[model samples]
Target: MTAGHLAVIGLGPGDEELLAPLARRMLDDATDLFGYGPYLARVRGAPGAVRHPSDNREELARARAALALAQSGRRVAVVSGGDPGVFAMASAVFEAIEAGPPAWRALPVEIVPGISAVLAAAARLGAPLGGDFCVLSLSDNLKPWPVVTRRLRLAAEAGLVIALYNPVSRARSWQLGAAFELLRQVLPPDTPVALATAAYRQDESLRLHRLRDADPGGADMRTLVIIGSAATRIIDRPDGGSWLYTRRDVPD
Candidate 1:
C-alpha cells in the first residue's frame, strides 16, 4: 500500500480563526490542492503545493482528478468552504469512487471536517439549533424541487428547526421564497427565522425575522437560513434587538 493519500479538508466558513488545526495542517502538508477557485483562494497552502482550481460546478471532475493524483503517490488535498463532509467535496469524491475503477476505492482518503455553515451561523445567532434540527440544501442542481419542499414540510411538521444551505442563488432565487411559504404552512406566523450571510466573515450579517415577515430577497449564495421550530424563542436584549434560541425540551 502506498503512503500517499487524499485529505479532504474544510477551511470553515470564510474565517481563518474558525479553521480547524487539523485542516490547516493538512492544507500545509498537501503536495497538491483541488477545489473551486474562490475556496482555493482562501487557503494558505504549502509553498510548493500545486492548486487545481476549477469552477464550483465541476465537483465530480475535480474529485476524479484529485483521486488520480492521490493514487499516483501524491499527497493531495480536496478543500471545501465548510465541513468537507457536509454537502461538499467528500460526497463528490465518494460518488466518483463509487463509479470509478476499483483501484480508486483502495486509495487512502481522510475526511477532515471543520466548522460548518450551520454551526457557524447557529453560534452567531445564539442557540437556534439547541434542540432537534435537520439541515437541507435548497439547491436543485441534483435533487428535484418537490423533494426539497417535501423535506421542508416534513421537518416543520415534526417541529424540527431547519438549517437551509444554498438558500438563494442567481439561478434559484425563487426557491427560498417558496420554501419560506411552505414552512409557514406548517409553522406559526411568529416562528423565528435567522438569516446569516457570510457568517464569521468581515461581511457577515445576521438578521432575525418572523416567518410571516422574513424576506427571501436578503439571502445570497453565502447565506445560511435557520428556521426555528415551535419550541424556539426570542429573548429581547437589554441594549437592542434579540437573541434566538430553541428550548432543549419541547414542553408538553
Candidate 2:
C-alpha cells in the first residue's frame, strides 16, 4: 500500500490574494488540513479537506497528528499564516519527522512557500528592511528570557534592521516593553519604528513611532513590529503620508 503524503503550506498574511498559486493547488489536493483556527478558516475553496484547528503554540502536536494522517494514506496539508518556515509549522513538521515514529520518516513531505509577515510589513512600511535585517520572536515560550534579551541586544548592537514577531499576547505582555528598553540602550531614542498590525487584513493599521515613544498597546498577537536600523530614516511624503526606508548606500 502506498503511504500518504504531507504538504506544509503558507497562507500568507491574512489576505487571500497573497496566497501562492502552488499553495492553493496543494490545498486542492489535500484530504485533510491542520493548522491554527484562524489560519485554517482562510482555506475558503477547498471542498473536501477535513480541517483540524488547534489553539496557538500547539505546533508539535499538530505536526505529529498531520504526519500520522499522512502515514495512514490520507493526503494532509499543514497550514500556517505566513511562510511556514518562519516561526511556523514547517519547522515543527521537520522536528516531528526527525524524532517521531520511525515510520513517519518514510512519508513524503513537501513545503510550499508563502509571503512572510515581515516581508508584507516591509512593503507596507516603505522598505525599511532594504539592508541587512533580522527577524526575532519576542515570545519566550520555547526559549529562556535571557536568551531572547541577549539576541535583542546583539541585533541592535549590530545595527541590523529588526522585525519582531509575536510581540505581545495575553500571557506575555511585558516582553515588548523589555525589548524596547534593551534596544534603547544601543539605538537612539528617535530611531524609526513601524508597528504593522494585521498586515493585509481589515482593520490593518501601520503607525510610525520613535523607539522611545513606541506604545505596546498598539500591538497584539497579529502584529509585526519592525524596528529600523541606525541608518533608517523617515521622509515626509509630498502627497500626505510619511515614508520610512533605509537607504541602500552606506557612508564612506
Candidate 3:
C-alpha cells in the first residue's frame, strides 16, 4: 500500500477557539489519529478519526502506530495539546519515523504550529518574554539530571527570562526545588515569576508571584513557570490584571 501523509496538528492549549482552521480541517480529514488520551478527548467531535491513545511511557509506541497507519495509506493526524514542536510530540514522531521501515521514510510530513504554553503564559502575564528568553523542561525522563540542572543554571546566569515546561511531577518532586535553589544563587529574591496552570482551559489560573515566594508544592506537569530576567518588572495595571515586562536595553 502506498504510504499516506502525516499531519502533525497542534490543537492549541485546550480552547476550541485557539485551534487553527487548518488544524481542525486536518483532524476532520484524518482516518486515524495518535496522541495522549487527554488531548484526543479534547477534540471528541473530530470526524471519522480512530484514536490511538498512549501514556507518557508509550511515546515510541504511539509514534510507531501513527507511522504504520500512515504507511498503510491512511490519512493520519498526530495530535498534541499546545504546539507539538515545543517540548511535545513532534520529536518523538520524527524519531519514530527515523527508526521505522524504509517505506515510511518517503511519506510526507507537515507540522502545524499552535499556541505553546510559553506563549499562553506570557500572554496571560502581559509580556514577560518581551526581551530575550529561554525555555527549559524540568523533566529528567529523557535527559540526565545534571544536564537539566546545568542548563537551568546557565540560563539563570545569562539573565534570560526563563520559561519552564514540565516543572514538576509526582515522580520528579525535587527537581523544581533544586531549580529554585540554583536560580536563587544567581537571581535576587524579589525577581518576578508567573505560574500558569491549565492555561486556556476552563479551570485556568494565573498567579504572579516573586521568586522567593514561589511554592512548587502546588505545581504539576500541567504548570508552566515564567521566571523573570533581571530587567523584568511587574506593574500594577488599573484594569486589575498585572503586567510583567522585560525591558530591552540597547547600547548607545
Count backbone clashes in candidate 3.
0
Candidate lDDT scores, in order, read 0.92, 0.89, 0.85
Taking the tens digit of each residue's C-alpha lDDT, what string does model 3 give over 200-250?
788888888888878877677889999998889999979987888888872
Tens-place lDDT per residue, model 1, 1-252, is 466799999888877888888888999999999999988987899999998999988999999999999988999999999899998999999999999999998888999999998999998899999999999999999999999999998888888999999998777789999999888788889999999999889899999999999999999999999999988999999999788999999887
lDDT pick, better of 1 and 2: 1
Best by TM-score: 1
Worst 10 residues of 1 by lDDT: 1-10
The full ranking of all candidates by TM-score, starting with the best, is 1, 2, 3
Clashes of each: 0, 0, 0
Q: Give the runs in model 1 whose Cα sits over 4 Å from its true position.
A: none
- Superposition error at 168 for model 1 (Å): 1.0
Order the candidates by lDDT, highest first: 1, 2, 3
How displaced is residue 194 in candidate 3, in Å?
Answer: 1.0
Enumerate residue pairs that collide in model 3: none
Candidate 1 Cα deviation (angstroms), residue 87? 0.8
**Position 107, candidate 1: lDDT:** 84
For residues 1-252, what per-residue lDDT tens digits would candidate 2 score against the true structure?
667999999988868789898988998888899999977876764687798999877999999999989999998999888899999999999998999889988888999999999999888889898889999999899999999999998998888999999999889899998898888889999999899998888888999999989888888988999999878999998897988999887677
